[model samples]
Target: MAAPALGAQEAAAAAHMLSLPAEAFGNDPNVEMVWAVKAYQHAQVYFNLISSVDPKFLKLTKADDQIYSDFRKRFSDLKIDVLDSEDMKSGPAKEKWRPFCLQFDGVVEDFNYGTLLRLDCSRGYTEENTVFATRIQFFAIEIARNREGYNSVVYDSAKEANLGTEVVSSG
Candidate 1:
């Protein structure tokens, strides 16, 4: 965003922006800047929704073959970490996630593309917690978090914040 850009909104005027600056994305060739930006933005939106809105009322996909329930059942059998660390995604650990990632083929957009993911469920994304991973890796972990009640802290904290706001207003 710091780069000079056209004020014009026209496609012809903005044709130069079809690809973003490489420096902004650390020049990861496998991950296009556009895809990474959109993926990150969507991830932020998803976190916001799960934090502000109850997960039970959420709908992720448009009437897939019970993907949510299916994911939970399938993921339950894995003996690996619950998508909490970068160790499980590299070298030998990849075996656990590679097949897992394959299961979500056609289920998630750009499942194999690189993405940023958080290490802890109790906290939002931060430099310390963020990890470079496949899009499927991010979803596989987060979806598991949502179903297993690990993301409850986000919702619970939101409720407490709202209550504090109400108390201040009443006072």
Candidate 2:
């Protein structure tokens, strides 16, 4: 009975494994690491838009789609704090995000794969500001952040002056 219980516990833990398997990053020579290129391009486009446009006017979803409002309704119960390392890496948060993100698997391109999300919405996608998240996790959090007015700092005059410079200087 104890052996069975331990197996069950392990199975449960495995369900929430958030880290992408190393092999899944593409070991095959023919694949040629397209996922990496796609992820990098995705980050560039995201940062380019945020660095220049006011978040309020930024439209991530189609006009009819309600991803932003839907994220608010579904995850309202979760206490979203500073969106620090814990929210991106902790088991509890990953478990919660997994199902929510998986729901968009067929809808959003590369919904389950790792992508870059900026730690602070106002900042550029620099090594210090970036974090890894599933594509939908990035969308869900950013859509909500943009909608709730938390991302207004991107448009601040001082930041705007440095925005182009930051992206060019960033590695």
Candidate 3:
């Protein structure tokens, strides 16, 4: 395959980064720059992993139900609760859920709060979003989400934005 044009690659990277909140980093410029780089690295890792499986998958369709089913099974095998309805409704169950959920600690410091929060704020964390899931779960949900139609809108918008700036050379 031919290499992506430099402008196209930069545009794509810029588009991917638009998900981050600028104001969140307003308190510290150095920290903000660090997080931006970390977030970009994390996103690159994810995109590479997903693309390796099937480059056209995201543009085509969502994975089958079995893919998501297997995701749940993996979570169970890892002893992480799926946080089912009954689990959510009970105080004890909710309390038990903390350990299973992803936490920012020693193991996660490489990614750190700046990067993790970027992913969480945009794609994970909420009930409706996939980021609330642990790393494996997050990957699973995002793979499925991209395959489905959900992620197409962002790219479409990105394309439009890129077009508007194609005339100017940032370099």
* Number of the top lDDT candidate: 2
**lDDT (0 to 1) per candidate:** 0.63, 0.66, 0.41
Which scores better on lDDT, 1 or 3? 1
> Which lDDT tens digits does candidate 3 get at residues 1-171?
122233667656555554567675567665545445545566555544443443225432133344445545544433221223433225874465444333323433221232221132123223332222234334344544555444444455555666667856563
Write model 2 residue lDDT over 1-171, tens digit each, in one string. 001222555444433332445575456542333344456667877766766788777878552146666677778854432468677689987787777777786677667777877787666667788788887878888877777777777666546578767988994
Choose 2 or 3, whichever is better by TM-score.
Answer: 2
Q: Which stretches of candidate 2 lie over 4 Å from their true place?
A: 1-34, 63-65, 77-82, 158-171
Candidate 3 shows a clash count of: 5
Clashing pairs in 2: none
Q: Candidate 3: which stretches are off by over 4 Å?
A: 1-40, 44-66, 69-132, 167-171
List model 1 lDDT by residue over 53-162, tens digit each.
Answer: 87555656552335445655655664323344645555766776577678777867656767677777777766776678886666656666666677777889988989
How close is every model to the real structure, measured as TM-score? Answer: 0.67, 0.65, 0.34
Q: Estimate candidate 3's alpha-carbon lDDT, on a 0 to 1 scale.
A: 0.41
Each prediction's RMSD to truth = 5.5, 13.0, 12.7
